[model samples]
Target: SPTTANLLLPRLATDRAAMAASASAPPHSLLLAAVALAALASVAAARDENGVYDPCSDTRIQRGDGFSFGIAFATLGAFYSGGSVQLSPCDRRLSLASSGQLAVFRPKVDEISLLTINTTTGFNPATAGGYMVAFAGRKYAARSVPTFVSNSSYTVSSFTLVLEFNKGRLQNLHWKKDGCGACAKSSSLVCIGKQTCAFRTQSCKSQGPVDCSIGIQLAFSGTDKHESVLNSWYEVSNLRQYSLYGLYSNLKDTLSGQFNKFF
Candidate 1:
């Protein structure tokens, strides 16, 4: 429930996995609690600052809490965005494979991160590629509202995981991971945008009930002046849990870390 401090809502946008023999936690849980407390305490004190919330919202952003199914944070210029984009059994057009589903959006060209979520668990090896959305890459359109396309990708006939970033402006912004604040992948040392970029397949093969997380930062070096800490992320396993208590705990933890990056 979005009302629960342990928000259970939207889900993915997959990339890879952990490195440390005992990988560090994504810091998602601790932060969610903090946000809850912040919203609660400040609701009366600094209510003006937290303009996004409404009088009806007794609690902060939780699962199903309006855009709660996905990400809580949006770029400086954020408008309408979010949803549980899923695919059907008959849609064989999606390149993803069998019964492939997705969740995607593009509020703007600079707004790269999509507060992505994942519902399936690593146990289901059936899940191979990831869900995806298409972006208009054309730079001129004002209020360039990026629309949601297909939902599934099993035995595809066309495209999947494709984003048409304005080729004109994106001429210089290629996928390169140069160990700056973003570069984390052991192999792809080139950072995309300001953050890091990495791709690993072996990162899956899980050990136990562990949440696998991967984030890619979109470095914006364009003329549009923007701050760092572009975005943070995590994908879920559908096989894992859709029920509130089961998935909300992990989902809150994921969003918590993402929110922390903002501060």
Candidate 2:
């Protein structure tokens, strides 16, 4: 009864808060658009995207699967952006760099971690899914390392970071040695060291002096007998370089076009 009470209470509270939040915030499609446009929008919401009913305050996310989840901002860097729900799962644990107050999580949920992000990828809060720095020192940062979300539990794992980056340049970096989909259908990827590995990779691959950028991505996690999808739209606001600008715009346009064409 206590366990059920604990779960139910949060749901009730969240339901009320979500109702209040929705009454104040924009409509669901616009909110979704805000989440999608985060790559480009300078201002966005601070609430966790995965906490409420994604479509609106009324749509409740089905939790209680014994999963741990939360969102973190770069404790050390620039402001965070975006306003949509991108659900990512991790092997639970967090550090200062990855530290944001735990906004949305199920209590006593097992080893869902928060460290592996920077280990395999860099931190870009505007994007959806890299591990926000929970801990950072002069040299290294910790992130959501996998194992918790894998086949060890119900015999499945989905520490899915379904994001897009420069394909041409990413291949150049030595991005190896991180948890990967152990199955044949899964692909392998590694996080680069903090030197903007994607930047180096993207820049070198280009013919002329150009800059490229990566936008709002979602790092999501959940476990079920079925699969879930998180759709993102990015509108570019600022870029690191001209090369970065072109890359962001191109990816945004193409992805937006493709998403609109089908849906």
Candidate 3:
């Protein structure tokens, strides 16, 4: 089998060499033919002694030629910034119970919308809240992060979703529909900085002084009742470190619309 697979490599290598030689203006047809041949070769190589190919074989090679998964189009400042933060379990279901809620990040979406449910009346999208999208900046010092801390840890353990803006600034978002309207509407929304802040990381320290003329930080309590919880984060970097295909197998069906444009 190894010898058989090796025998097919010469043609692919020759095609690649030819393409590189004519990189300036290779014929489109040639490119398509090469791609098709490569796919066929991979399928053939991934077959077993029984001549049956494993459709989902890990040995198969599929180049991610034209795919674009980049988010965070723009950075807040000159430093490292702008790119979608990934979450685990991208397709979390909504809770229908009286005390149920779910948080999901739509890959390639622009806005973050939160919907609320009233136990007696049911779900209310009208009362739901939304925000212009943003990504959380690097966590500096614990005090520098903008998030709510429950005075009574017993009532609400603690939760945070911080987004960064220009000048090393940060804000916490709860990803909910209602509440937090005033903060989003205000041009000069007052926020608690070093005065009243908590760190998500245990060993939090200040990177530097970052100024944010306008930002949003919405607070919510985890202790509050919810029907079911599907809190997960997606890490885009994981795709490459591990096997590529299975990384997003679960999300392929549930993922919707253009990744950059979320409803």
Span of ten consecutive residues with least summed lDDT in model 1: 37-46
24 in model 3: Cα distance from truth in Å?
A: 53
**Model 1 alpha-carbon drift over 4 Å, by segment:** 1-101, 107-114, 119-126, 130-173, 178-206, 219-263
Model 2 error, position 208 (Å): 11
TM-score of 3: 0.15
Alpha-carbon error at 106 in model 3, in Å? 3.1
- Once fitted onto the true fold, the runs of candidate 2 whose alpha carbons sit more than 4 angstroms away are 1-60, 63-70, 75-197, 201-251, 254-263
Mind sharing the TM-score for model 1?
0.27
TM-scores of all models?
0.27, 0.23, 0.15
Better of 1 and 2 by TM-score: 1
Clashes of each: 36, 48, 24
Overall lDDT per candidate, in order of appearance: 0.23, 0.23, 0.19
Q: If the candidates were sorted by their lDDT against the true structure, best first, what order would they fall in?
A: 2, 1, 3
Question: Lowest-lDDT window of 10 residues in candidate 3?
Answer: 31-40
